[model samples]
Target: MNDSAAPVAGKTGLEFALLAEDGPARRGLITTAHGPVKTPAFMTVGTAGTVKGMTTEQVQASGAEIILGNTYHLMLRPGAERVARLGGLHRFMNWPGPILTDSGGYQVMSLQELRKITEEGVTFRSHLDGERHNLTPERAMEIQALLDSNITMVLDECTPFPATETEARESMERSMRWAARCRAAFTQRPGYGLFGIVQGGVYPALRRTSAEALIEIGFDGYAVGGLAVGEGQEAMFDVLDATIPHLPRAQPRYLMGIGKPADIVGAVQRGIDMFDCVLPTRSGRTGQAFTRRGSINLRNARHQEDQRPLDPDCPCPSCSDYSRAYLHHLFKAKEMLGPILLTRHNLHYYQELMAGLRQAIEDQRLDDFVAGFARQEAEGDIAAL
Candidate 1:
């Protein structure tokens, strides 16, 4: 609730400007040390300094202004120290745009059987080599700094769904404490930003408390974490309705690790300004393509003879240059190109969705856009050739 703590622009290189809004929907731009990101942005996931099937250029070509890197993965493999010695992640990954590095809290939380959490930090064995490692809030900041991340997320516990109110509170409070430590440990630099994650499970009051706590500590941006993890869409929206209002309007609001096309649209409508997810790329590798008319599986025999593009309207190479039948054949044959081409198209579709949302907000027609998008998705992929 205190706007003074959160400024839209400051001496720091990371800045955000609210250009327009349609009701709760926002259209904005985030300026970082690396570059500028047009809001309602979808950051392609480059988990291990690579976007799986696509190169940095390919990711950039999909209209992505930013990409996310995983501290857990990078530190375990090539090592953050190595990345810094090689001129940071930008040069190492060949990506020159803005980069956001998560604090590894979520990944640590997922390693329930392998990790132990205490007041200081989490200690666990690396999944890659079974090597022991420690990750504290300060250490998390150190690793991201080593990677020279443009946007650094604070370390926070990703509270599991179905957690009791007491358990949620305990996890959220520890995350808040860790966030404060991250802020203290983070180095201030122009064009660089440190974001705090808001945790609290599905409880509204707890969410409010978490938001207020992060606002007090202050951050370049605020992210709502621990959703889309088995919580239904309606419940997720309800949590957003409860949390988004508490977040600073001047700074960007990111919904972490969220979700399908419909989820993004609904979150944007509720005032979320940024997002990242592995769904599009992961689904692509499995032969799933996201079209305007919902998702379709290429491995299904129904597409074996269809000559249409994945989505006739998509301008990506997979759609404009290749046919669904060919795509199907590639998947059937287990060709590597099938995943690459589909991943390209899927990323393009996600970016196009974001662009459409931004345009709708600018035109003050977000309501109409959302309705139409739902209609198209409901109609399903064009009556199967």
Candidate 2:
């Protein structure tokens, strides 16, 4: 993180090039140390070094160019130092493409009763074995560096929702200070980079202030944090409306921990370029599948006798080789294969959605694409069996 006014001379970090734009929506490419990621990209959640049931090759086959790894989970289990010893996360996980690591702030925030936050950093007892650990902005940077992350996020307090203006401002300012420390502590690499996160809960003024402060410090990219944490969609978009204009347009903008398919579209419409979430995979494990006609539950009775593909449009093996009836049977029988198949299908569907959005942005038909998408969603899943 060079704390200096300018980046270390001759050390060019991550590179982003905007190839097309359709109003606020953008089509771009992010070249990282590992590889290139096409934007408006949807990074499959590979928390704990794996995307759950799917192999790295299966994840890659789902059309994902980038995947997200959680610092909190990895640090607690396999350990960051151990990961570094094993040739970093990419080699450890066998995922050759780019990997972005969260600084573990959000996970720490969620450990409400188990953690304490101070100006210096957060201290928490590990859920695994009740052992104590400290995570400061500098330590977060070091962990990500040890993991050899292509994109590392600055550690910022995840401002809780429903905070008063004063509370939000206090949290935002502290996060800004931590952002500066992270910037200074980060090790500059040619293709690896650090992203600064903007925190302010839902207060527009504080959001602007946080954004401005991070910009002053500078980063390889900007991320909108503290949204989707109980703030409804409209409020989240409102925050984006207030915050995005102040961000540097030439660099990538990421919306952290965001959401359903429609949520991604709406954020992209508001100019967000990257997203990661557990929804699709989590939903899949619970018998839900995403489709152009919205999401459907394979556990339902209607699917038990329906012989059609889960989504005829999807080329995933779950759809190409199995019928809705078979999928329903797997779930009903408590078979492990049920979740595995559905997870693959869900990731494939998400990748397809991102590809569609990218193509729409490139063709300057984003509005039209959105229109059709809304129409299909409104129509709902195919008529009951």
Candidate 3:
């Protein structure tokens, strides 16, 4: 966002310190341009430059240190070139903190009917218009640099599940090649880092190969990709169990585009240090709220006359000030406030959850924390109490 293009000072623009380890879970600190983010942090996805209803200040107030931007979305609308002209993503979005951007490869692949892939890159029709465009690994690196992202992800094919072993291997190899190009093209700055993604379907051996290949190319960080698309939790965890051990213990481990509350906790227990997901924001807009227990649908008739807050323990502005009936009324009447309040509450829950996780890891009681979490989830809504 600064767009100064001034080189970052010092070695390893970003530094990860592994302070403690309990079983597979880790407690550490990630140093970034904005500040040092505690490990096991959940980055709210502010795709297209904003986190939906919440303002940047509000997001910070909720204890978020960093946010995510989508390269594909920004590239398509407002254009990366336009954003660069306006002073990069941070200044443009008025968020001065750290920002991490995805490589735009995932969205391009999702455009199944509009895309064609080759050795060079992928050519796809813009979902917004019929306009044709090409995105290669080099182009993705350049785009992230223009965005002034603190962390940039490598452009890799997110191979979907159920593919044949041959198909999965082919896709994995392509992603590895792209990772090399992406690493070569990345601009190194102090506090800024490029991460390589590991992509292999459900095969343990394939996952190991992907991890080894990315390590050989070398990167500031590493991510476990190509999971959670359709693979159930057990399969995802199994892959993580096999893959995480192979990753460098000193570097931060990121699990991309994953998951529900349970998924986050499970992944963390399996040794993931970083995460980004659209569930909290997207589900909020659809009338869902995640509490200490499980998820709740506010659209239920049970909330019609309920006078309690969404979560009695939650300290978010929404839960602190508004009643279930008020939120329910707003949703029933199709008011924008419903989405806004729910979004805030859900983010608050997520941040609080991360805080709890970090504390648990630091205390070397992750197992106990996880056990308590399960018990609470089984206990159900606190509002009914």
Q: Which scores greater on lDDT, model 2 or model 3? A: 2
Assess each prediction's global lDDT (C-alpha) against the native: 0.91, 0.91, 0.90
lDDT of residue 159 for candidate 3? 99
Q: In angstroms, how far off is 180's CA in candidate 2?
A: 0.2
Q: What is the TM-score of each candidate against the true structure?
A: 0.97, 0.96, 0.96
Per-residue CA lDDT of model 3 for 1-385, tens digit only, reads: 1112232232456887777678899877778786677779899999999999989999999899999999999999999999999999999999988899999999999999899999999999999988999999999999998999999999999998789889999999999999999988988988899999998899889999999999988888899999888889999999999999999876889999995888899999999999999999999999999987678888988899999898888999999999999999999999999999999999999999998998888788999999999888788755563
**Full-model lDDT, candidate 2:** 0.91
Error of 2 at 321 (Å): 0.2
- Give the worst 10-residue stretch by lDDT in candidate 2: 1-10
Q: lDDT tens string, model 1, 170-274?
A: 999999999999999999898899999999999999999999999999898999999989999999999999999999888899999996899999999999999
Q: Write the per-residue lDDT of candidate 2 for residues 348-378, one digit (tens) a residue.
A: 9999999999999878899999999989878
Model 1, residue 203: C-alpha shift (Å) = 0.3
